[model samples]
Target: MDKIQHQTRPVFPFTAIVGQEEMKLALILNVIDPKIGGVMIMGDRGTGKSTTIRAIADLLPKIEVVSEDLFNSHVSDYDLMSDFVKQQLQEGVSIPSEFIKVPMVDLPLGATEDRLCGTIDIEKALNEGIKTFEPGLLAKANRGILYVDEVNLLDDHLVDILLDSAASGWNTVEREGISVRHPSRFVLVGSGNPEEGELRPQLLDRFGMHAEIRTVKDPSLRVQIVEQRSKFDSDPYSCIEEFQDTQKQLKDAIIFAQSRLHDVTIDYDLKVKISQICSILNVDGLRGDIVINRAAKAFAAYNDKHEVMIEDIKQVIILCLRHRLRKDPLDTIDSGTKVSQVVNDILG
Candidate 1:
């Protein structure tokens, strides 16, 4: 639709948000480098976990998308496009482009399997006597953010479907004598209160980084947070306008980071340091190293730097490796302290 129609949707301004710095940083890191996988936020309810994520859409710069593409595919980078579509481009067909709003699809807890994975269009199939594929939430979330709140309570089958789509960057359907596959390469974001339930380990591993959010206990900070939120709730439109300049600056920073990400280089010494820490800690899988490297690079890019440094790697290590590391057997040490120890032992 038109710009006015699109702008009607309400979004909380990122700068105006209160507390939850860790949650905000982790989410921004993912945006800077989606290959770091996605961010998982675990916290108590009403800590702004969901609000911070939803506000990300407002902070992001609009992307150039393919005209008439259901998935909002990026015209500039067709990395996730199907082989069939790629072949069409090779055959000299002109691919059109349109500037559209970036997607941020929220998958609710009450959604069903059929609604998640495309179900057979019974009406169309029966009327035409031919199987037709109806797209689902995954399809709608392509090349954007797929947010799942209360993720710990998601049904097992749906969790499997989400994991499969995330792993392969595509969703495949086979039913009623019809088969279809489409790109489903959205960044997976999940937030939930751990007291409700623990996330399945398999699904948990899909998240590249995790952050724990807690209510701010500082009296002055808490008061400021409450007052700001109350005023925004009372006059969201004017409050957002007041914060528009800050939002624009953040949007520019993200755009600049995305452009510089490719040019950013990591030194071999820093890579070795990253590997040494993960190896020393006996962390499983090479994914930790990959995430650490990507997170560091993104951090450097966010700072408008061309080279990754030990400081950047160290800054994000807790968020990057916290969820991946096994629990200490002693149970006496805090995770942050343990992480710091590992960093100090290696980097010092």
Candidate 2:
């Protein structure tokens, strides 16, 4: 019992995962520059989408929070905390803190609006005739990752609510005649197998970047994946131990990127390239332009480079602009392939 409480369940190491370079890069760039927004992954059913995300969540650095702050708000930012907590702090009340691993919350399918965004406490309202607010998944996900699997199958109304909170960074719940608002900032991570269904365009725009994944076609790569998974299933701890140094190196690299992200700058020429690509692709709004700019800068930072290059921009073009393209009524090519061709034509 003690060990379970003190430790985390074993996860497949991010370093041990096979292929899907595009998916892995999108996830890493989000961590480096969350302002690049979140990721929307569409892929085949057995391509390890959910597993890769959960593994990245486990590999992230720990965060420090005020001892009893329910929202897990950063200690320095009082605004992220509740009014009552802020009041206590204003009165010079000493609040201790503890370091805990960053959260990775899963939003279960079929969750009610109230469950996703809290509601009036029913017991309190009935017993004491006083309304009390109950925090839900949105509150718990503050400053963390909020993952939704099979997002295409999610109800439209629920999808709207999630996107609303994500865009506004606040969850507002009015129910049982009680109104409450709280910070709900989080990185939205969603995955779906396209065979299940396609995402709505409005909802699709909410994602910052999109990537597609498929099964490994090479027989040797397939065998390596199976062997690695079998070994981990048999000895999870030992597998983790073996990957420990590699994991630390990657984690440290992410930290380095984050620290110097602001120092990484995009040149005017690269900015023009971004706009030209978006124009040729006919992406709606300016989202494609903006996401590409951010993702490219992040990619350069991840490589320990202080300036964005044409190569950095090229590497992330498909991921940043894939979902933003308005589909052609007559074109027969897949979105990813079309994006690649257009990018090469514009940038080459």
On TM-score, the candidate that comes out on top is 2
Q: Give the range where candidate 1 is weakest over 10 consecutive residues by summed lDDT.
A: 1-10
Q: For each candidate in the order shown, give its overall lDDT on alpha carbons.
A: 0.82, 0.86
Question: Which regions of candidate 2 deviate over 4 angstroms?
Answer: 1-6, 122-131
TM-score list, all predictions? 0.92, 0.94
lDDT of 1 by residue, 261-333 (tens): 9999999988998999999877788888998899999999999999988788888998887777676577787
Candidate 2 lDDT trough over 10 residues, lowest sum: 1-10
Candidate 2 clashes between residue pairs 3 or more apart in a chain or in different chains? none
